[model samples]
Target: MPKPANDNTRFLVADVANLEAEIDALLGAFPDLQEDETLRADMLEGETSLQAVLTRLLGHEREAASMVTAIKKRADELDARKKRQERRQAAMRALMLRLMKAANLPKVPLTEATVSITKGRDSVEVLDEAALPARFLKVMKSPDKTLIGEALRAGKKVKGAAIKTGDDTLTVRAA
Candidate 1:
């Protein structure tokens, strides 16, 4: 299933925080002077209008703070979820290696396992000689469904076999 889009409030919160930080940083770097009449007019807009600005600024700051907290919380949750998936994939890879080792077959790296669903052929062959076993080498020379079916019928097993990664599906079934 597809995930829903994130809330738009997050961007607003981030913008508010950045604006606040910039305001503070500018004030600290260049202290205000009372020499300019325009500056004095804006600053001296006391009590009523200044109060409204203060109230709105406070609300924006609160929203920004809350958004930052929420983003951090979501990041931690995603990190945990990703770690769990990695561990599961690692476990499956280990199991596949063990199964192939037991079957007296050369260990096929996950990257080298180029899976395909061909209509005429049902067999698997390791093309790389360094990674290929003698039995698999013989299979590669003559690619046929009959040979593959006969091997499968005799209870011979292939390892790291699946229609897709982490599928746990057998090669015979795919065949």
Candidate 2:
């Protein structure tokens, strides 16, 4: 019998979940299985369903990773183009400023916009950091992860900190 769209979708989801749970159970049984030992398809209910599902999932993972790489490459290209445009605009502004200063004009009026030359605000410049007094310097402190990890690994207790072990990650590869 032909199923409705929603029913078909629900069935597929439940089926995949069941397949995953079966695989987990099979792996859990062989905690000390050696590399030479083979897990046959007969271990699962369906003959080759496990192999098919694993192949599909691995292919999807690789496709997603490729998409991310392409997106980052395009973003980098756009950023470089934007920076070049900014540098060009700055250069044009500097040329206009030089011309106005040479002609002794404080402001110039245009149909679209008005360009003006104004005195910049006063500011302090730091020449040498070592020569500065303690009052003028600022100190910042932060936790060191490397030292904390070492302490935890050596069985030393650190206040307000503890190491956590996460679930195993699956590595997808072409075979």
Best candidate (score: lDDT): 2
State how far residue 149 of model 1 sits from its true place (Å): 77
lDDT of 2 by residue, 1-175 (tens): 2242366455655667888787676667755432334444345535437767666556655776999999999999999999999999999999999999999999999999998998999999999999999999999898898999999999999998899998887776556
**Using alpha carbons, what is the TM-score of model 2?**
0.76
What is the TM-score (0 to 1) of candidate 1? 0.38
Candidate 1 global CA lDDT score: 0.58
Give candidate 1 regions above 4 Å deviation: 1-48, 107-175
Residue-level error in angstroms, candidate 1, position 125: 35
Please report the candidate that would top TM-score against the real structure: 2
Clashing pairs in 1: none
Where model 2 places Cα greater than 4 Å from the true spot, the runs are 1-15, 21-42, 45-48
lDDT of each: 0.58, 0.77
lDDT of candidate 1 over 1-175, digit per residue (tens): 1222245545544555665575555446545624566664454453124445545646655677789999999999999999999999999867776777677666444586842322356797656788765665554364565666566667786453222235464231111
RMSD of 1: 25.5
